[model samples]
Target chain A: MITRRLPPWFVNALLVPLASVLCGFVVAGLVVAATGSDPIAAFSSLFQGAFTNQDAFAETLVSTTPYLFLGLGIALGFRAGLFNIGAEGQYYVGGLAGVFLAYSIHGVPGLIEIPLALAAGMLGGFVWSGIAGALKARFGAHEVITTIMLNYVAFLLANYLIDGGLMLAPHVSTPRTPEIDANAQLPIIIAGTRLHFGLILALVAVPLVWFLLQRTTLGFRLRSVGFNPTAARANGMSVGQTLVLSMGISGALAGLAGIVDILGVSHHMTDTVGAGYGFDAIAVALLARSNPWGVLPAALLFGALRNGASFMQLDTQVSSDLISVVQATVIIFVAAPVLVRWIFRLRRQQVAEVQITQREETAAV
Target chain B: MEFLSHQDVVGLLAQTLVTATPLTLAALGGIMCERSGVVNIALEGIMLTGAFVGYAVALATHNVWLGVLAAVVAGMLIATLHAALSVSLMVDQIVSGMVINILAVGITGVFYRNYIESSGLAGPDTLPHWNIPGLSALPVLGRIFFQNQFVTYAMLILIFAVHVVIFKTVWGLRTRACGENPAAAETAGINVYFVRYINVITSGALAGLGGAYFSLQQIGNFLPNMTGGRGFIALAAMIFGKWTPIGAFGASQLFAFSDALGSRLQIANVHIPIQFLGMLPYLVTIVVLAGAMGRAVAPAAVGKPYRRS
Candidate 1:
C-alpha cells in the first residue's frame, strides 16, 4: 500500500495543513451562522480584532509565547516516540517553583533572579517528567494512567498550597500567590502591548532545540531510542537512560512555558495559570508532526484562532465554545492522518503516520 | 458511630451492593473488552452513548425494557464505530478512545442541554423497584440480597455469566487468544479480527447496559459527565484484576467502597483535609497501579494494527 507516486507539488506536505485550516474556518463560519449571526461580518471583525491594531497583534503574539515553548517541549519528546501527557502537571509544578523562587530570593540582581527562577521552573518540570520516565524504564508502568493520575495530584497539591500553605492573599477571596519582585519580571518587548521578552525567549528556544537535536550526539541517541528501543539497546545505547533524559528535557521545556506565563507575563501566580496550555501544546506539537522548528507556526495559528475567538463570538454571535469543537476536530484530523488523506484522496503516504500513543493505546490497560 | 453498628453494618453493605451494581457491571464489560485485546477506553463514551439512547427511547416509548434494549443496541452501534476507527483504520487507539470520549462529552452536553432547556419534554417513566418474595423478609444477608431493583440482580447474574462464558467456553478461549496474541491465534485458525470484533461490541453492549442502570434504574434524568472518570477507574480495575472478569468485579467493589467511604467521611465532618481523604481512591489507585508495575503486562498485540506484514 506504500504508494510510489508522490502527491502533486501543491497538494503535498504544505497543502494538508492549509486545507485543515480552511476546514476549520468553514466550520467556524457555519457555527457562527447557526447562532443566527453573520459569518463574514463576524470573521472580518475577528480579523480586525486580532490584527488591526498594533496592540491586538502584540496580544496575539503574547499568548502565542507560551504555546510555542510548550509545543516545542512536547514536540521533542514526540519525535523520540515518547508522549509526555504530564506536560500540564509539569507546567503547574514549574510555574509554582518559578514563582516561589522569585518571591523568596528578592535581593538578587535582575539578571540573576530571572534566570534563577527559570532554572527553578525547569528543574521542577524536569523532576516531574523524570517520574514518568523512571516508571517507564524501571517499572514498565504505563505513562498514560500515571500521567493522568499525576495531573490530579499536581493540581490538588498546588491547590492546597495556594489555598492554605502559601496563601499570599488569604483575605482576597481567592487562592493565588504574590507577585514576584520587579527584578524577576520579564521586560516588555513592545512599548504598550502585553508582549514581553518571553516571545523572544521562546523564539530563541526553538532554534536552540533544533540545533541540539540536529547536531548533537545526545539527540541522536534520543531519536534512536525513540525509533526503536530494542535496536538502540542492541547498538550499545542506554535506552532507559535516554528515555528518562528525554522525558526530563520534555518536562523542562514545558516548565519553561510555565515560567514564561508567571514571571515574564503575569508577574504573579494563580490557580488558573496553566489555562490548558499543556493540552493546547499537544495539538500544536501534533500539527507540527513533532518538528521543533515547525511548532512555532502551528502554535501561532492556534494563538490567532484563540485570540480571534472572543471577537468571533461577540461580533458574529457565534458560540465561542465552537472554538473548542473546531479545535477538537483539528486534533481528530491530525491524530488520524488517514482521515485527512481519505478526505483529499491523497496518494498513499510516503511513511506511515507515526503512532504517538505510549502503551495500552487500546482501551484495556 | 450509629452507621457502623453490627446490625446497621448489614444495611450499609446492602446499600453498598446496590450502589456497586452499575460500577461492577461496567467493570465486567471493561474486563471483557480488555481481555479480548481492544483497549476499551471508550467505556465512558460508550456508556454515555448508551445513557443518551436509553433515555431518548424510554422517553419516546414509555417502556423500561425498551429503553434497556435501545441502550444495548446503541452501545453495540457505538462500539462498532470505535472498532472500525481503531481496529480497522489503524488510528492510534488512545486517540480513538479519546475522540469518542470528547465527542460523547460534547454531544451529550449539547443534547442534554437542549433536552432540558429547550425540548420541553416531560420526564421519562422510571423503573419500579422489585423485591424478592419470601427472601426479602429474612435477616441481614437476606435483606441485603433480596431488596433491590431488577437491574441489581441482573448485574450480578450478568457478571457471573461473563465469568462462566469467559472461563468455561471455547469462545472465551478464542477471545483471550486475540488479546494475548492475535497473530499466533490467527495462525492457529482462529479468526482473530472476528473474535475481537464480537468481543468488543459485546463489551460495548455490556457498557450500555451498565449505562441503562444509570438512566433507567438509578435516576430518571441524565446528567453530563455522570460517568465521571468511572470509566477510567474501571480501566484501572481491569488491569488491577490482571485482566480477569472476577478480578475486575472485586476491583470495582473496592473502588465503589472507596467512593461510599468518601461520601460517609464528608458527612461525618471529619476535619482531616477531605481533600487528601478525597484523594484517597485516586491515590490508592495510583499506588496500586505502581505496585502492579512491571507485573501486569498487557496483551502483546494490544495496540498493533494487523496488516499481514
Candidate 2:
C-alpha cells in the first residue's frame, strides 16, 4: 500500500495563517499601488512605526490589550457555537457601568474599589449580553439577530444617558462621564508610555481562557454542545445552560475590555470609548482560528496594523483605511480556504474533512 | 391639544412611503435570497456598495440612470463573490456574508477617501419627483401615492411584481423547492445550484437598487456606512413577513412609518429624548423578532450549502 503522510500539526497550523496573511498583504499592496503609492515604502513605514521605538512599541501594547480581551471573549463564544456580535454593545455597557460605579461609590479603599469597579463593568456586560442569551435560550431567537439589534439599542441607550445629563460630566460640555476615582484607576506599568496594568491582566487572561477551554469539564460540555447539540443533549448535557454560561463568560471578558479601556487608557467613559475594538476582535478571533492561546499573537498583529496605519498614511499619503481592506481580505482568504489552497497549489487532506463535517452539521439541521 | 392636522397626516404618509422604499426593496431582495436557501446578512454591505458606486458614477457621468446601473453592477459583483464563497466553496453562510460586509465597507471607504475626496466636487443632483397626471389630482390618495420620487413608484411596482412572480411562477416554485429541501429538488432533476445562483444574483441587484435610492434619490450623495442598520432591519422585516414579498413590504411600511413618526415627533419638539425616538425602529425589530420566533419558520434548507455527493 502506498503510504500517505500528514503534515505535522504545528506546520499545518502555521501554514494557513501565514499564507492568508501574506495574501492579505498582497491584495493590500495592489490596492496601494492602484492608489499610486509604493507598497514597499508604505509597509516599511508601517513596520517602523509599530516597532522602531519605545513609545511606538508601548502604544502597540496599549492597543493589544483590548483586542486580547475581546478576542478571548469572541473565541469563547465561537467555541460554544454562538456568534456574539454584540461585544461592541457589551463593551459600551461595561464601560458605562464601570464609570457609573466609579463615580457613585466613594471613599472605599483602593484595594476594594478597583476590583469592585471592574466587577461592575463585567456585570454590566453580562446583563446586556445575557438579554440575548436568555432570549436565545428561552425563545429560540437567533443570537446573531438579537445581538445586532442589541448593539443599536446599546448605542441609543448610551446616547440617551450621556445627552440626557444622567451620566454627563458635571462641568464638562462634552458627551462624557466624569473621571473615575483615582483608587479605581489602573496604574501605568511603563513610566513614560500609556502602557498600564491592563496588559498584564490581558496576558494572564490568555492562559486562563486556554485552561478553561481545554482542561475543564465545563469546557468539554460547551465544546460538546457546539459540536452537536442534539448529541450533547442526549448525553445529558444541558445545552441551554452551557450556552448561557459560555455567553455570560464571553460577555464578562468583553466587559473587562471596556473596564481596562476606562481605567488604563481613557480614565473616563466617553461616547466613543471602546469604539471598534469589539468588531476588530472578531477578526482577531478568526485569525486565531478561535483558539484562545493563539489569540495573543493574532491580537498583536492587528494591534501593530492599527498602530502603524497612521504612519503609513503620513508617509505614503495612503489612506489608513487600507488597513481595513487588508483586514477584510484576510478574513475572506481564511473563510474560503479553497481560494488560498488554489493560489498556493497546496495539497488538502484533513481540511476537506473539516469542511465536510461543517456542511453535514448544517445539512443535518 | 390639536397636535395633528390633515395636511400633516398626508405629508407624513407620503414621507412614510418615501422612507420605506429602500427598506421594501432590500427586504424583497432578502426574501428572494432566503427563498433560494441563502442567508444574506450582507444586504447592508451590498446597499453601501450600491450607494457609493451610484453616487460616484452619477458624479462622473452627470447621469443618475447610469449611476443606478453602475450601482447594480457593483452590488452584483459583491454578491457574486459571496455566492462563490457560500455556494461553490461551501463556506459558512453567515461568516461569508460578514466578510462581504467588511469588504464592502473597506472598499467603499478606501475609494471614497482616496479617490473621491481628492477630486473636490460637490454632491450630485437628486432624483426628480414624479407626479402622475390624473392620480396627482386625487384627494387623499394623490398626496399619499402620486407625489413622490421615481424610486418610490418603482418600489411599489416591484413589490407587486415580486409578489406575483414568487407566488405564481413555475420558477418561483423551483426556487422555493431548492430552499425547502435541496436534496429533494436534486432528486427531481432540478438544477438547484443554478436556481440559487440566479435568485441570489437577482436579489443583489434589487438590494443594489435600494442602495441607489439612498444616494441618487434620497440624499443625493453617499456617506460612509449610510445604510447603517437598515439591512438588518430589512432582514427583520423579511422574517416578520415570513419571507413573502407582500408580507415583507407590509413590514417595511410599518418600520418606515415608525421611523417617519420618530423624525416628525422630533421636529414637533416633543418632550421625549430624541435618542429614545431614534431607538424606536430597532426596539420594534427586537420585539417583533422575539414575538415571532416560534411562529416564523425559515425555509428548511436556508443557511445550508448543498454539495453533490
Candidate 3:
C-alpha cells in the first residue's frame, strides 16, 4: 500500500538522494560535535559562503563548472558499466594538451582558438583513457586498476612537463605553463567576477548528454552492452567497440573539464591543476545515480560544499576537510539504498510484482 | 654510474625490501578480501586511517606498540563499515570502498589539521631497527635480510603465513568457495556471509599493519595522503599476482625495486628526470595489467553479493 501510494519516480529521483544528503549532513554534524565545534554555526557559515555572501555564488558557480563537466564524464562511463577512475590523470593530460594548443597559436580569433583548444583537450583525455579501454577490450584487463595506475602516471607526466620542462613559462617564479592567448581565454560573462563562459558550456552539456543517452542509437547500444555484454554480443553488437567508444567519450568530457578549468579559471596549466576535482566528480556521479540530468543538481551540491568549505573553516575553526566526510557519507548512503530505506523506514516498491501480474493476466486473456 | 658500488647495490636491495613491505601487506589484504568474494578498494583508505590512528595514539600514549595495535583496530573498524554496506546491505562493493577511502581522507585531514598541526606536537620516534645477532655479521646477505624495522620483519613473516593459511587451511577453502561460487557454497552448508565478513576484516588488519609501516616504521610522522596510492598499487599487485600471497609478494618486490632504483639513480645523479623516476611504479603497474606477462583472472563470484532464496 505504501509503495502504491508514492510514485516510483518520487521515491527514487527525489526522496533517495535528498534523504542521503540529509543523512550525510547528520553524520558530518556528529563529526563536528565530536571535534568540539558548533555544527549549526559551521553549517550556517557554509550556507552563507555558498549563497548569500558577495561574489560567493559566482565563486560557487566557478567551482561548479569543473564538477559539472567531470560529473557528466563519470556518469557517461557508469552508463557503459566502465569504472574510469583515471579522470584525474585524463584531466591533467587534457589541461596540458589544451594549454599547449592554446599557447601555440597566435593571432587566431577567439571563436576558432577556443574550439581548437577544447578539441585538443578532449583528444588528450580520450587517448589517456582509451588506452585503458583498449587493454580491457583486448586482454580482459580491469579498467579500475588501469585507470588508477594511469592517474599517478598522469600526475608525474604533468609534473615533468611543467617543472623546468618545455611547458614552463619564462620569467615566472612558479612551475607552470605559459598563459593562453587573450583570444583563447574564456571571457567572463559577469562583470568583475571570476565566472566565465565555461559555465554556459557546462549547462549546455547536460541536455546534450541526456539527448545522446536517451535518443541516440549509440547511446542505446552503449546501454545495452552495459546492461548485459553477452546479450549485446549475441545481438550482433560489437561489445569491444562500444566499450572503447564509451570510454573515449567519457574521457573526452573529463578532458573538457580540465581544459575549461585552465582556460576559464587558471588561464594556465600547473602540475597541481587537478586538485582532486576528478575524484570529487566520482562522488558527484554516484550522487546523481549516473543519470545525466541528475548530474546538474549533484554537481551544484558538490560545488557549493567546496566553495563554502573555506568559509566554514574560517567561521567555526573546523577544518575544510570536513566536507570530505560529508561527501563520503553522502556517497555511502547513495550507494546503499537499502540502508537508506531502512533508516527512513520506507517500504520496498512492488513495481516488478505488479508488472509481472499484469503480463500474466494479459497472457491468460 | 661509476659511483654505484657493490655496497650501494646491496643497500638498494635492502631498501627495496623495506619499500616493498607495505605493498606486500596491502596486496595480501587485497588477496584475502577478494578471495572471500568482497572487493576491497578501501585498502588505501584503511591504511591511511591506520597510519593516522596509529600516529595519534602513539602521540598521546608514547607507546609505539600500542600505536600499532590502534592502527589495526582502526582499520578493522573501517572495514566493518565496508562489510556492513557491501555484505549485509548488498551495496555495490566498489562504491562502498570508495566511500571509505574518501571518509578516511576527510577524517584524517580534519584531525591532523585541528589537533596535530595546531598543537605542534612532536611525533614519537620511528620503530627500532632489529639487527639479527649472528646473521647480521654475514657480509652482504645479512644486512640486506636482517637489519630492518619491526614492520619489515613482520611483512616477510606475513607473506609466508598468508601463503600457508590461504592454501593449506580449511577456512581458506571455505573462503575460496564463497568467492568462486557463493550459492553453491551456501548449499554446501558453508556460511558465505560469515566467511566474507571474517576475510574482509582480516584483510583490514593486514592493511592496517601496512599503515604502521609509514607512520611508526619509516616516517615517524603522519602526513595526509601519505599512503600515496599504494593501496591501488597493491590492488594491481593482487591482480597481477593472480590473488596469490607469494605472487603478490613477488609483484610487490618488482614494483618496489623500481621505486628503489629510482632513488638510487637520483643519488647517483643519473640524467633521468625525477618525475620519471617517481612514475616508475605506476607505469610498471599499468604495463603489468596490460598482460605483458599473461592474463590474470579474478574469482568468479568475487564482487557479487549473495542472496539466498
Candidate 4:
C-alpha cells in the first residue's frame, strides 16, 4: 500500500496542525461575524497586534514564554498518562514561592539570586502537583478531579496570601505583593522591550525536555507507564513511582513557567497572575498531541493569539474571548484527526490513529 | 453552640438546600453521562451555555419558563457536539470535553459582552417562589423543606425520579450494561452507541436546568463564568456519591452545607480566614478521593471510547 506521497511524519506533524489552524481561524471568523463585526478586519488587526505593531512581536514572545513552559509541563504529564489540570494552581503556587524568595533575601548578585528563586518556584509547583500524584498513586484517586479541585484551592490560597495577608506590600493602593529586589529580577534581553532572559530558559527547556523524553530511562518508564501501566508493571517497572515522578516533573516545569513570568515580567505577584493561562495550556498540549517538540509551534500560536487579542478587541470591537473559540476549534480538529483527514481529503491513516487512541483509553482507565 | 439559635439552623438548612440545587442537578447529570460509559467534564461548559442562553431568552421574552426551556435545548445541542466528537468520531472524550468547555466560555463571553451586557434590559428575575399553604406556616421544618422556588422543587423530585429510573428500570439496566461492558451489551443486542448518545444528551438537558438555577432562579442577570467552578464541584460530588443519583444528592448536600457554613462563619466574624473556609469543599473532595472513606470506583468503561469491530 506504499504510494508516492509526503512522509507520514510530515503529514502528521506539519500538515495536520497547519490545516487545524486554518479551520480554527475560519470558525473563529464566523463567530466574529455572527457577533456583528467584520471578521477580516478583526483578524487583520489581530495579526498586526501580534507582529507588525511596534514591539508587538516582542510582547508576543513574552506571552509565549509561559505557554512554552506550561504546554511542555502538561505535555509531559500526558506522556505519563496523567492529565495535570492543576497547572494553573501549580503556576500560582510557583509564583507565590518564587516571589517570596525573590523579595525576602537581601543584596546578592542577579546570577546568584535568580536561580534560587526559580528553584523555589519549581519546588512549589512540584509539591503542589505531587499531592495529586501521590493521591493517584497511593489511593487510585483520579487526577482529573483532584487536580481541578486543587486548582480552586490554589487560587484561594494565592488570593489570601497576596490580597491582604502575609505577602501584601505595605502602602500599596492595590492588593499586590511588593516588587522584588533589583537583583532578583530577570534582566531584559532586548532594549526598549519587555522581553527578558527567561525566554532563553524557556527555549532551553524544549530541547532539554526532548532529551529527557527521548534519550533517558526515566522518559522510557514514563512513556511505558502511559502506554500501558499494567504491562509496565508486569515488566517490573514501578507504575506508582513513575506516576509520582512524572507529575512532579510536570509540576516543576509549570512552576518554572510561573516563576519565570514573575522574575521576567511582572516582578511581583498579583491575585490575577496566572488566571486563564493554565487552562489555555491544556489546549496547547492537546494541539501539540502531547509531543514536546510539537509544543513549540502550538505554544507560539497561542501566544500570538493571546498577545493580539486585546488589540483585536480595541480595533474591531470584537471581544478578546474570540481567541478562545479559535483555540477550542483548533483542538477539536486536532483531537479528531479523522475529521481533518476527511475534510482535507487526505488518505486514511486509520491504523496509527486508532492504536494511539486505544493505548490512551487503556491508560485513562 | 450558643451562637447557633433555632432561627439560624432553619436559615442555614434553607441556604444549604438553595446552594445544593445546582450542584445536585449537575451531579445527577454527571451520573447519567458517566453511568452510560462517557466521561463528561464538559458539564461546566454546558451549564455556562445554559445559564447564558436561559438568561438571554428570558430577558428577551419576559417569560421565565421559555428561558428554562431554551437552556435545556442549548445544553442538548452542545452535548450533541460532544456525542459527535467522542462517540462517532472516536476522539478522546477528555479532549473533546475540554474543547466544548473552552468553546462555551469563548462563545458565551463574546455573546455576553456584545449583546447581554449592553442590552440595558432587566432580567425577568428569579423564578417565582411557591409556598405550600399549610407547610409554609410551620415553625422550622416548613421553612427548610417546603417553601422554595420552582427549580428547587423540581430538583427534589428529580432526585427521587432519577434514583428510580437508574436503579429500577429496563432502560437503566441497559445503560449500566453499556457502561460496565459495552462489548458484552452489544453482543446481547444493546445498541451501545444509542444508549450512550441518549444518556449523554439527557445529561446535558439536566445540566442545562442546573444552569437555570444560576441565571433564571438565583440571579436575575447572567455574569461571565457565573457558573464559576460549581460545575466542577458537581463533578466532585458525582464521584463522592459513587455515581449514584441518591448518593450524589447526599454529596451535593454535604458540599452545599460547607458552602453555607462558610458564608455563615464569614457573617459571624469567625476568626479563621475566609479563604480557608472557601477551600473546604475542594479539600474535602481531595480527602474523599484520597480514600478517607474508601476508593469510590467509577463505571468500568467510563472513560473509554467503544468501537465495534
Candidate 5:
C-alpha cells in the first residue's frame, strides 16, 4: 500500500485552479447580481450553453484549437524563459500567409495542397517571430516590449493586406481575404459537425510537445537556458541562437493554429479573425503554469467558460464580458501562487513547529 | 528665394510643433516615470482618465482651469493605486501598469455610458488659447504657438520645467539614482521606494495633464480610448530619446510628424497603401524598438523590488 505523498501533486495540479474556478464563479455571481440578474440561472445557462448540444460542443472544439496552439506556443516559450507575447501577431501573419499561399497557388495537386497551405502558415509565423528572436539574440532587444509593439504592427499589416493586396473577395466591404478552394479546407471530422481535423492535430501535438520537452537534448538546452542563461552560455549553449530558434518554433505553432482557422473554422482570413486569442492565450498559458500537459484542462476550462458566456448573457441580461473579468481574476490568482500557498502553508508550518517544540520538551523532561 | 523656402519649411515646422504639443507633454511624463524607475505604461490610461474627468468636470463647473484641476485630482487618485501596487506591494511593473490601464478604460467606459450616453454635459466648453500678444504676431510662429490654446502653453512650460528639474536639481539626481541602481542609492540613505513613489505619482499627474490637452484642448470631448496608443508611442519615444526628457520630446515630435504626414498622405493621395501607411507608427515602433535594443538600457534595478530578504 504505497499511499505515497500524493498531496504535493494534488495541491500543485488540482487545488490551485479548482480554487480559482470557485472564486471566478463567485465573482461572476456578484457581477450578475450587479446587473440585476439571477446568479443561479445565469450559471445554469452558462453550463447549459457550453454543453447544451452538439453544436455547442462543436463551437467549443473550434475555440479550443487556437487555445491549444497559443497555449502550447506560450508554454514552450515560458519553459525556455522566452516570453513570446507576439503570438497574436504571429497568428495574424500566419493566417494571412496561409490565405496568401492558398490563393496564390490555386492549381496545386490535391494531396500536397493542404500541406502547402499549412506550411505557408507555419512559415509566416516562423518569419514573423524570427525577427524578435534575431533582435533578442543580436541586439538584446527585450522580447516582451518588442513583441508587444509588434502585435500592433502585425495588426496594422493585416489591415493593409485584407483591405488592399489580399482582398480576394469582390465585395471587399470588410477587412478579410477570399476563401480558399474547398481542397485547401481541413476535412470535417464528425458528420454534421463544425469540428474539424484541427482537434486531431492539436491532440497529436500534445504528445509530440511532451516528448520534445522531455526526451530531447534541445529540451534540455532550452530548460537550462531558462533556468540560467549565463550558466547555459558558460556550458557552451548558444543562448542567443536558442532564443531565436525557440521563438521560431513558438511562432510556427501559433501559425499552425492560424492554418487550422483558415482551413477548419472560418475558411477565410479577416481583420478580426484571431479575435484576441493572442492576449487570451497569455492568460491561458499563465493559468496553466506554462505546462504543456497542463494546457489541456486549462484550455478546456477556458473554452467552456468562453463558450458559455453568450448563454449567461442571453438568459440573465448580464454582459457576457464578465468572462473577461473572471479570466483576468484566474490569471491574477495563478500568477501569484505564493498568495494561495501561504494560506495553506501557514497551517502546516504551525503544526510542524508545534511538533518540534513538543519533542524538545519531552527530551528536556 | 532661399528665405521663402526656409519660411515655407518654418510654417510647416511651426504647425508640426503645434500638433506635437500634447505628444511632447505626454512623452515628457513617460520619461519622468521611466527615468524614475517605473515603466508607467499606464500613461495612456492615466491620460484617458484625465481627459474624461477634466472635460466633464470643467463642463459641469463652466471653468476650464477647474476641469484641469479635477483632471489632476483624478489622475493623482488613479496613480496612487498604481503607486500602492508598484511601490508598496512591489508587483510586476508591466502587469500592474497594464491592469491600471484596463481599469481606467473600463471605469471611463462605464461612466461615459452612464453620464454621457444620454446627457448634454458630454460636450464640454473648450479652453480658449492664451495669446502671448507679441509672440502671436511673430509671423508663422504666432499662428502655431501663440494662436494655440492654453494647454499648449502649459505643455511648453512643463517641458522646460522638466528639463531644468531633471538636469539641475538634487531631487532629480536622487530619482535618477533610484532608477539606475536603487541598491547603492539605498545604501547611501536615499529611500529608493520614496523617490519612486514621488516619481510615479508625479508621472501620473503629468500624464493626466497630457490627457487634458487631448480632450479639453483638441477634440473637446472624451471619445473612448482616444489616447489611441499614443501613450505607447510616448513610451517608444522615451526609449528612442535614450531616456532624457529633451531627447524623448524630440522623439514625440517625430511621432507627431509621422501622424500628421500619414493624415496628409491620405488627403494628398500618396501611392503608399492606406493600410501600410496607417501602420506607420506601429511599424516604426517595431523598427525603433528593434534598433533601440542595445542602445537603450533600462535602469538596472528598475523592475526589481527592493527587499532585504
Candidate 6:
C-alpha cells in the first residue's frame, strides 16, 4: 500500500501544512471568482505586490517583525498548556508603557533610552498578563475568559488615556500619544525602506527562545506539566507556578512585539497601534504547529499576505477581506489534518499502534 | 444627585430588557452547545452571519419573518461547518471556532460591500412594537414588560421555555450525559454524535435569532461587526451562570443593566470617562469569573472529540 511507503514524519510535519495552504489559496480563488473577478489576475497581482520590489519586500519584513514576536509568545503559552488569548491587551498595554516611558525620559542618551523603552514595554505586558495568570493560578478561572475580558479592559484603558489628556499628543485632536524621542527610535536597516533594527531583534529572539525551550530544565518542567499535569505533579513539579511563569514570559514577548512595532515603524502610540497583530499571531502560531523555529516562516507567510492585500485590492477591486478568508481556510485545513488526508486520498495511519507507543513513553517517563 | 423617579426607573428597566434580550438568546445558545460537549467560540461569527443575512433578506423580500428564517439557515450552515471540523474531523474545537469567526467576518464584509452596499438601498424597516392592550396599560410593570418589540417578548418566553427543556426533560438527560461522558453515553445506546450535532445546530439557530434582533429589532440595519463582542460576553455570562439557561439569563440581565446604565449616565453628563463606562461590563465579567469560576465545574468531555476504538 502507498501508506507503507510514505514517510510518517514528512506527512505529519511538512505535507499537511503545505496542502492546507494550497487549499486555502484555492478557496480564496473561488471566493474571488464568486465576486465576479478574475481569480488568476487577483492571485498574480497578490504575488507581484508582495515581492515585486525591494520596497514591497521591506514592508513585508516590517510586518513580519511583530508577528515573529507575538507568534513566539503564543507558541510558548501553548507549550505550557495555556491559551493566552489576551495578547492584544498585552500588546496595547506594552505600547502604552513603552511610549509613556520614552516620552518621560526625553533627555536620556540613545543607548540608555532605547533599552529603557523596550524594558518598559516588556514590563507592561508582563504585569497585564500576570493579572490573568494570577487569577488562573489562584482561583482556577479559565484563562480564555479572563484573557478575553482583559482585552476589553485594555482597549478601554488605552482609549481613556489617549482621549483624556494623559497620553494625548499636544496640538493634535486625534487620539494618540506623543511620538517617541529620536533617542528611542530603532535605527533603520534599509536606506529607502521601513525595515528597521526590530528585524534583528526578532531574529535574535528566535535562537534565544529555541535555546530556552529545548535546552533548559525549566523548559523540561513546563513541557512535562503540559504533557500530563497529574504525572508532572506526582514527580514534584508545581503546575500552578509553571503556568504563571510561562504566561508571564509569554506576555513579555508579546509586549516586545508592541514596542518593536512602535519604535521600528509607527513611532507613536495610536488607537490602532498593534491593530490585529495579536489575533493574527494566533493563526501564525497555529500554522507553525506552535514551534518556535517554525514561527519565522509562518510569520513571513502571514506578512506577505497582509502586505499584498492592499495591492490586490488596488489592482483587482477585490476587498482585502479576502485575505481573512484565505487565512480562515488555512486554519480549518490545518486544524483538521484528517480532512487533508482524505482529500489527498492518503490512508489513515494505525492509531492503536500510536497509542501503545504513547502509553509506553508515558510509563517510561 | 437626585434619586431616580419611579418613571425613570421603569424606563431604565425597559431599556435593560431590550439590551439583554439578544444576549440572553446568545447565552442560552452557548449553554446548549457547551452542554453538548462542544466549546463554541464561534458565537460572534455566527451572530454576524445571521445579522447580515437577516437584514439582506428582510430588505430584498420585504418580509421580516422570512429574513429571520434565512438568517437561521445561514447560521446553521456555519454551525454545520463547525460541527464537521470539531466532531467528525477531530479538530481543536477552539481553533475551529476561531476559523468560523474569521470566515464570517470576511464573507459578510465582502458580500455586504460588493452586493448590498452597491445596490443603493435604504435600511430595512424596524420590527414593530407590540402594545398588549390590557397588560401594557397596567402601570410600571406593564411598561417594563409588555410594551416592547415582538422579539423582546419572544426572548422572555424563550428564557422560561429553554430553562424548562434543559432541566426537566428526558432529552436533557441524554444531552447532559453525552457531555459528561460520551463513552458512557454510547454504551447506554444514546447517539452521542447526533445529539451533539442537533444541540450545536440549535445553538446556532438561537444565535441567529439573536443576530436578527440586532438588525431587525434594534437598529433596522446591519453594520459590520455590530455584534461587537456580545458573543464573547455571552460566553462569559454562560460561565458566570454556571452554564444554566436561566442563570445565564440572569447574568445577561446584569450585564445589560450595566450597559443601559452606562449609556444613561453618558446622556446625563456624568463625570466618569466614557471609555471607563464602556469598560464596566467587561470588568464585571472578570470579577465574576475570578470570584465564582473556581467552583464552576465544566463537563468532563467538553472540548474533546469522542472516537470509538
- Best-fitting candidate, measured by lDDT? 4
Q: What's the DockQ of model 4? A: 0.63
Q: What lDDT is reached at residue A141 by model 1?
A: 66
TM-score of chain A of 3: 0.94
Query: TM-score of the candidate numbered 4?
Result: 0.96
Worst 10 residues of 4 chain A by lDDT: A354-363
The digit string of per-residue lDDT tens for model 6 on B1-309 reads 453677788899999889998888888888888888888888989999999999999989989888888888888888988888887777767777889889998888777767777778877788898999999999888999989997788789888877877789988888899888899999999998899998888889888888888999998888877898899888877877778888888888888888888777777887678777667667766766566434556666777777876
Q: Per-residue CA lDDT of candidate 3, range B1-309, in tens?
A: 676789888988898899998899999999999999888899999999999999999999999999999999998999999999888877778777888999999999888877887878789989998999999989998989999988899999999998887899999899899988899999999998899999999999999999999999998999988998899878877877889999999888888888888777777778688777666667666666666666566787777777777
- Could you give the candidate ranking by DockQ, starting with the highest? 4, 3, 6, 2, 1, 5
Candidate 5: clashing pairs of residues: none
- Report residue A107 deviation for candidate 3 (angstroms): 1.0
Q: Which tens-of-lDDT digit does each residue in B151-181 have in candidate 4?
A: 8998999999888888999999999999999
List the TM-score for candidate 4's chain B.
0.97
- For model 3 the local lDDT of residue B143 reads 86
- Identify the leading candidate in terms of TM-score: 4
Any runs in candidate 3 off by more than 4 Å, and if so which? A1-4, A350-365
Instruction: Answer with 3 or 5, whichever has the higher TM-score.
Output: 3
Q: What is each candidate's DockQ, to 2 decimals?
A: 0.29, 0.53, 0.55, 0.63, 0.22, 0.53
lDDT of 2 by residue, A102-123 (tens): 8788888868988888899899
What lDDT tens digits, residue by residue, belong to model 3 across residues A47-87?
99898899999999999999999999888888888887889
lDDT of each: 0.74, 0.82, 0.86, 0.88, 0.73, 0.82
* Real interface contacts reproduced by model 4, as a fraction: 0.74
Docking class of 2: medium
Of the true interface contacts, the fraction found in model 1 is 0.22
lDDT of 2: 0.82
lDDT (Cα, tens digit) per residue for candidate 1, span B88-188 = 77766666666666556655654454344345777676777767788888888678888888678888888789998888999998888887788888899
Candidate 4 residue B308 Cα shift, in angstroms, is 0.7
- For candidate 5, what is the recovered fraction of reference interface contacts? 0.23
Scoring only the A-chain of each prediction against the true A-chain gives TM-scores of: 0.91, 0.93, 0.94, 0.95, 0.90, 0.93
Task: Please give the distance, in angstroms, between residue A120's alpha carbon in candidate 3 and its true position after superposition.
Answer: 0.6
